[model samples]
Target: MRILRTALLVALVVGVSVSALAKADAPLIDAVRSGDVSVVRALLDQGADVEGAAADGSTALQWAVHEGRAALVELLLGAGADVTATNRYGVGPASLAAENGNASILERLLDAGVDPDTTMPGGETLLMTAARTGEPDTVRVLLARGADPNVREELRGQTALMWAAANDNAAAIHVLAEQGAHLHARTDNPSRSPGRTFSSTPATGFTPLLFAVRGGHLDAARVLLDAGADVNDAVSDGQSGLVVAAANANWEMAAYLLDRGADPTHAGAGWNALHQTVRTRRMNVGFGTPGPFAAGTLDSIDLVRQLLARGVDVNARMTRNGIRDGQRNRFNRLGATAFMLAAKVTDVETMRVLLEAGADPLIPTADGTTPLMVAAGLAIWNPGEDGGTLSGQEDEVLEAVRICLELGNDVNAANYRGETALHGAGFRGANIVVDYLVEHGADLTALTEDG
Candidate 1:
């Protein structure tokens, strides 16, 4: 009984002692976190440990640096606070200072022997971080302190200029360029083996200008172009800035590139800018949301006009089955033309535009699937979707079908699989298209190769 009572007494004493220690530590940390310089100094005078860490392993100096409190940082440093203390994320005072664009705090950290080019866990450098922050002064400080402007990160082999361009930091781009950053440097492109096909993921082989263009940063792109960037530079798959702009529905950027001497006829491995523009327009506006055309839609139309005026082939065809959302499907898009893409989505206005521009309606896919057949629901381009049609778009699709037939298309044309428009209409349960095809002399007894 006496021993049990002694053990309880010791437990009570230990608990009180730990509580007292926590009380002593909390005030200093709270003072530092709140940027209360006087209170932090008072706590230091009261013999608080300078190296005491918060719950996340952030020391007083690190917190001061993170808070951008230069005076507090100086005080902590004078009190012998550890500058190298890191938090749970491996972020130290220097990293916080660099990311916050606090040049003074970063300078102090550097004066305390921190490397100006300190890298994150992923090998991203301080210059890259500052460049992404869009603060030119922070980037300049890092560069002046010996950070490499052209240093490539290990992950993507991207430089500080690439980071700046990607984040739309025009000032940082200017600074990096003035400091001799390689304006034409390309990111690492993974080597493709022979006979091995790659998806169009935009994963590699991007220049800083391509990054800017892909991000839709017109200002950044302008800065890059002014810096003598090649407007026709392409990725590994041969997609130029103009093609990327068209694919992303960034018609403004596309127009800008065209104005700056971008090649309108540049064809990537998959599709040209025209095909991408049609496909992306469908994805953006959807099948039939009834409203006035948006400003972006108008811009896209204008861009299409510009491409046509620049001698872009209105009858251009896709060279390969480009990247799609679902790759497991049996949909093959090779030899598809812009007019065919417009018909597939039942885009009546776009179809009109293409037709007026002399887009051939008789062009077919590799399997001989014609634009008229596609308009009659003859193919499943993206399976599990309603053949790219919406609830209120039956009339528009029927109009597209009418336009195709009026263009002298053969209604009884069969693909390689012996499937006609009637087969596709029946498979899709498109009663409107089926009735129209029957009235237009579509063969009712026509059977597929399977039949």
Candidate 2:
């Protein structure tokens, strides 16, 4: 049986002529590497596998296509190279050609039966990949070649349009939209599985609207909004696009959403935008970013003022995380009045804004921490020359102390630690603030366990 099998192999080799078959075997590799049309033609004439691959899993046609050798690519295709043949990682010849900017080669491969919708390991389709490069022409070619505009990868839930939108690829987005891509399709599954967290979701779990608002594509957000995409669709942790827009300081987008009835007061937002801005600024802590919050131009303090003007609770306490037994939609234990938040940041404008809007400075916190206590503590804890206004630092601290007095705060008010604002100033060596506190009837004799 071994002898018979050997004889059959010998006969097959002889039938094709050993030299001719040997030449056919490696000819495609040589032709692509050399970009030579005649060698490619000879190999095809001798019945070589026109799609023969190198050790790395790239085919002869892939090499020719990637090199932009139009003639060799044509010859290989005519020899029946499988255009859709994927590399080890599933990147097809058309994708390889697209990667190298060989559009002509891409066209030839597509014409030779490459599937434009072929996906990579993570379910990233060719169109999604192309959109990531921000190449409008490649995107247009793929769309025109019948790639489904709304096709989504199962793992990531990313559509081609989503990729374009997330990358801020305006032209590609325009082309994909014109080609009928579904803008509303979620690019990532927010509720899929524990394995598919917001961090793990494909393309950031961002919808077209979230991408638009976060990426500063106000125009795109407007377009999507007009097309009937829900303005209030919350994805991760119940954070809506409006929330992202507000968090990012993209005022135009926020205003746009607000105008379209997007509630500035979103679920899971510990406080409204205005209150958050005030608290973050006063504490010298940003909402998420670093530095004193500038309350950038896009912030709708005006809108907040308007809400307050209409009698929305200016002194409302936000349900923050540090609070205890907080009922849903009700003030939590750590909830700070608008005035408390304002005093912490020492933004005179914010203070003025809240006060004008009817926030009562007299309200004391659960721990007996008043707005004055918060301001004095912030002034002491916040370090450096830029901590606050140097010239009026003492006066500002003193003024808060005086305001508390006027508002009927206890003359010797103490906090959970039994520390008054005076203790904070004296321990920190803030002579000016301490002097002001003492002169304004702060209890010099008050002593906590630390004192």
Candidate 3:
């Protein structure tokens, strides 16, 4: 089977080289494909352009590098093929060799004076490319050859540190940092700061700090803060590391930022950390979260309790103004009464903790989505899929509904989409929830806009 695979690969290479030669200077590329080092040497000896590019901008050296023909690559390089020259897409031979995980060929090119830090067409440096492809050896080789660890790409100014952080390449990130990669440099948030232009400023005004937090790298976050990096540095989007930590449910990092003077009040400011917590706890599965410390070891419930105890203002608002045209709406606009995020497994406990922590169950979300509504809506999908109803626990959803009602939740409140909790229940075929709501005197005659 292995022999068959080898033969197939060889045939494919031959076929591709023949096709490429049919278009432009195919013979040299074919010789490289066939691993005919002597033939490649002869072509170069005859003054055929070793660096002469094909129609796709690939030189003979690039074909050799792609095929892992180390000796052929060396021969082309000896013939003065521009080892640093990039193809049309900016991927040079070094970068391709790294992509193919050919560390030996990469070292040969580097030793022969090929530039390892060269950027491809889209601004990916050979080092960045190597790290992304999980070629740790190639990464080491590039770094040893003085590839700029802190080199920022074109669009977002992401240094190798940022790339490693975003991809959770801890070892590569550490190597670059240990080699004096700037940990505090910021990159552009193109998603938030659209229409922004790139500048050569060393201070990208956005650093790798928040990315560390977003990645939930507690150790990395500690390292950055210990290096005197700003714990409260805000991104171009006006969000801080504290906010990202909370978004990622990195409580340890969140707690660390708080200890370092991170203001949780600045988080979901108009919405509040407690408010965001309620929403986030609902997406626990989506976030790949582990349940809180322990059922008693500080479960999600206890974690919420701790944040509140730490002065995360439970009643804080997320946005100041109400909704408007062409402007973002604040999460606090849901009548500033009792609100509920959509239900998830952790949300049940989160709701219980919030009620215990003084979260107003009366205020609806900005769009009039209520806690009971969320509970009922989630019950319909059986999001927990624990063979349960919308209320989750045998009585948990009902208990939460009862709390909201006791806290003055308008059982008749309708969302902006004109759906009520009962409608949501009926829509999702949650008969248990429908029956429970009816028993609790829930209005059944209410009609929604969609209905």
Candidate 4:
């Protein structure tokens, strides 16, 4: 009878203790979530496990950091919470705190001997994540905590400073550089090239400054340049910083890079920076659809001047034969030289800028079309005769022709088909252009082989 009573009492005591522990677990997490510090302290004193993970495999520390509860985070850390604990997404406390710019929480975690360079599953360290966040505070704090600024991510092998430049975060860039981040580290991601990133067209690899220029972040680009980034670094596709800037028509960055001694004449895949800027100038508006007018015309002209000042050949032709008249909408692909590209622009100011900078007006493309012929054809172009900008286009074309003539381009230059400017002007019975061509010294009797 004594043994039975003793066994029964011990079993009851064990059951009550298990019940208390079970009761303590639920409220601890609840307290942390509700930001009830007192309740959390009480549960901790009552023998609740500090590392109790929630359903998402995240502990109270993860919750506190994610909720941006700095005070709660401190309390939890003091209670022996694991600073390196991550949620289901592999996002750890340090990454969360860095993203939130929670400096105090970060400091606490670091002081507790948590590695400042702790990264997620994708190899995104605290510094890389914070750099792209555009807030420099977290970046600075992490650097002070001994985060490696030169550490690369898994996918692109890009460093923290490169991520900042890629996202156009100037403030973050400033902070990272102040702590000795590398400026010219190149990406080594194979997936970025040869359609490996899940598409047919390949991607361009980048340096930190290349990303800044590609993103059109003028201030960020300037910062990178000042940090001794190489202006002439090229991608796997051989595109330099100046070339990318010109390709995006980022005239401001282009000009600044040019001033910083970036090569203006550097060509990639047969297209030079000068030729790319002119290509942008030459893209025509769609028929009968109003489009945003091309902006930064004056900036473009200034960029051209900078290129000329750099001693780029005023008549540098492409290294490869042009792609012309394909189903890819390649027509009048006079992408051969800056002057010929100016002819395709049909803008008087662009033509004037090129001519003033010593771009020859009479240069014929491989197809033998001249600025005079291109102007005459565009002047009489009637987009269904009902397009709203028809009058403006006609005026522009006429002005383009006048500018070409004033620049002394040959009036009688013919193409590979033996077709003169009149042939282009009189195409599809465009008599307005034919009459204009006739008045401007184009011979009417000139004919192609078929004619």
Candidate 5:
């Protein structure tokens, strides 16, 4: 009975002591978080736990470094705080310092024996983090302290220079380049898994220049180009810088790339920048009311003119087994020209531009689908599923049909499937186009090959 009483008394005393210790440690963390140097010193003097962590596993020293409290950081280190302590996110004091652009604090941490090349949980190095901050001093400090400028992250194989370029950090890009970062380092190429075909997988081979162009960072792109980055470098999918710019309707970037010797005729299989530009514009700017034209529309027109002036073929056709094969509706077909693509979307303005640039409206696809057939909504294989209807685009389709007819397309012409523009209009339930076709002498007796 006596021993049981003594054990109970001792347990009670130990619980009280542990609770007191926790109470003492809580104030130290709060003091560090609030940047109270005197309070932190007093807590340490009172034997507060220097390594006490908040709920997120952030110790006093880590908080000090993150908050840029150099004096508190020094005091904590003197109190035997762990410099290598990390938060639950795997972010250590050094990484926080780098990400915050506190070069002096980073140097102090490095001097205190933190590994300069320490990576995050995902293998992102301090230099990569600093580069993304757009601070040249932090990047310089990391590089000077032996952080590799060319070191790639484990997941994407992206270097510090790539990160800098992606974030529009031109100064960091310049520094990384001077430190021997690879000018054309690409991300890891996407691998085709066992059941996945190459076309089903997305392209992942993006260089620093491509990253800059993808973000529309003209200054970063210029820095990379002047540093000898390849202007014509493409991803695994063959999308070059010019094609990317065209796809995004970035006329300025496209013009810049063209001036820097980007091949206007460079094609990914059968699709060129012109095709991308027209297709992208059609998707972004749907057929609205006839316009005085938006600023973006005018810019796209200028880009088209520039592409034509640079010698892009106005009548270029998609190849038999091209990059966009089996992708969707009319665009999936072979021998389809840019004019036909514009026609399919009922983009009368683009069709006019193509005609002015000498595009042949009579050119047909491999299936003998003419620009007129496409304009009348006859080219879609599955009219119900694909965007084949001229429901709201009756005016545009009528104008396009008129343009095709005026350009000498025979209204009675039939595709290889024996389907005429009338059949196309009927398939899409476009009574407006059907009536117009009938008025234009479409052969009502025409029958498809199946009939």
Candidate 6:
């Protein structure tokens, strides 16, 4: 916005200007920055150049805008400061005003005939800047003055609408959309990150509707839908809004999408909403989550119920995503069932929800690893939580083991390795689960194919 905020700029400009003119008469720049009106007037009277730049190419006018000094901005402009001067990041006075939503300063710059279409170094225009900063009023003023809402940023080809959608700025989104923003525009050449669900699609495949879901902006999503966004629209990989909604644990959005005709059973990249809904962290999270506390166990449980009621395949399995090795990888080796994924997680509430919703506890994968064996084989403490007494966590995992046994999953069932659920527990030091399994008739002498 301001190239950087004052707090950060203060840190960046730790010493004197590291420039060739380190000893030049740069008091006008320093005075304007400190908001010392008397010193600024004195510098102007002393024939100081009003358009002088700092080490980073930031002109006095740009610094005034950053400091929110409206009077100083006007004074500098009247003293022949160039409104078009920019900083190292190509952010000028006008762009800074719009980004900060400083309407008064922005009006003066716009009235001075500044071109609103000019972009910063990264192709961010005034409207895109305002939208990213959640500034509806600035967006309205710019649009009214003939700013192009559909103008694509040069780098990512994102219009102001895309930025609005990404930031959850529903008001800005509405303003831009009403001003003729393109609804179905896809980003150009999106960055590729393999470790993300949003990356299930290739670059250049994200639409505004998909971005809304990715941002978890329910109101913005509804606005787009009411404005005629295609509910069934998907990325190039066929990751529909419904699948994203569920995968992101956005139950309300998922519900709305289903009501709007999104396919509840749509699968993308060999996985469905069921796989994402039950996943504790990896798939459903850690891939640019909206916020740290945005997803929760309660929401996941609710989503599980919603998907089940909407007729998603409860025993839906995702093939083992990639090559697997090591005995501890058993849970993932055999294509994972939703129940299996949930059992390996500590959130037993979600596991219970799936179980109650008719997820088969004994469903086996290609290698014969069932959800029961997966739960029993899980380590009592996560690697991060190792070296602690395993009582609390052991109880949680044992809850899944108990549920599986009570529901008739074989206590002695083995995987392709011939390792029983009891053996699985024994491998991971799940003594509590081992005792329960043995009490339920688990064979003590079972051996893996390796043994």
For every model shown, what is its TM-score relative to the native structure?
A: 0.87, 0.67, 0.66, 0.72, 0.84, 0.80
How good is model 5 by TM-score? 0.84
lDDT of 2 by residue, 1-451 (tens): 1232243234323323324324435556665667777877876787777666654455677667666788877777777777777655555667666655455667777777778787666666678767755678888788789888788866657677766666667777777877787766764554443121111112334677676766556656666666666788655545566655544445566667777767656545455545543433333322222432333465546655644654447777766533111112121225577677556544556667777777788776665667776556433333322223331265665565566556766656787668787776665455876777787788888888676
| Worst ten in a row by lDDT for model 1 | 191-200
Q: Give lDDT tens digits, candidate 6, residues 294-364.
A: 34334656667877888988887775352112112324434677777766554567677887877887777
What's the CA error at residue 117 for candidate 6, in Å?
2.0
Please report how far candidate 6 places residue 96 from its true position, in Å.
Answer: 0.8
User: Residue-wise lDDT of candidate 4 within 143-212, one digit each (tens)?
Assistant: 8878899998776677888878977888999889888888877777776441111011124467888778
- TM-score, predicted candidate 2 vs. hidden true structure: 0.67
Q: lDDT of each prediction vs. the true structure?
A: 0.75, 0.60, 0.61, 0.67, 0.74, 0.69
Clash number for every model?
Answer: 0, 2, 22, 0, 1, 0
Q: Which regions of candidate 2 are displaced past 4 Å?
A: 1-92, 96-107, 134-156, 170-206, 277-313, 322-333, 363-368, 378-411, 417-419, 423-429, 444-451
Question: Could you tell me which residue pairs clash in candidate 5?
Answer: 378-424
Candidate 5 residue lDDT tens string, 338-414: 88878877777788899899999888888788888878877545443232233236787788888888888889898
Q: State in Å the error of residue 431, model 3.
A: 6.1
Candidates 5 and 6, the one with greater TM-score: 5
Off by over 4 Å in 6: 1-25, 30-42, 154-157, 188-190, 193-204, 259-261, 281-292, 295-298, 319-330, 333-335, 346-348, 378-392
Candidate number that wins on TM-score, 1 or 6? 1
- Once model 6 is optimally superposed onto the true structure by TM-score, how far is the C-alpha of residue 333 displaced, in angstroms? 7.1
Write the number of the candidate with greater lDDT, choosing between 4 and 5: 5
Question: How accurate locally is residue 56 in candidate 3, as Cα lDDT from 0 to 100?
Answer: 54
Query: For model 6, what is the C-alpha lDDT against the true structure?
Result: 0.69
| Top candidate, metric lDDT | 1
RMSD list, candidates in order: 9.4, 11.1, 8.3, 11.9, 10.0, 5.0
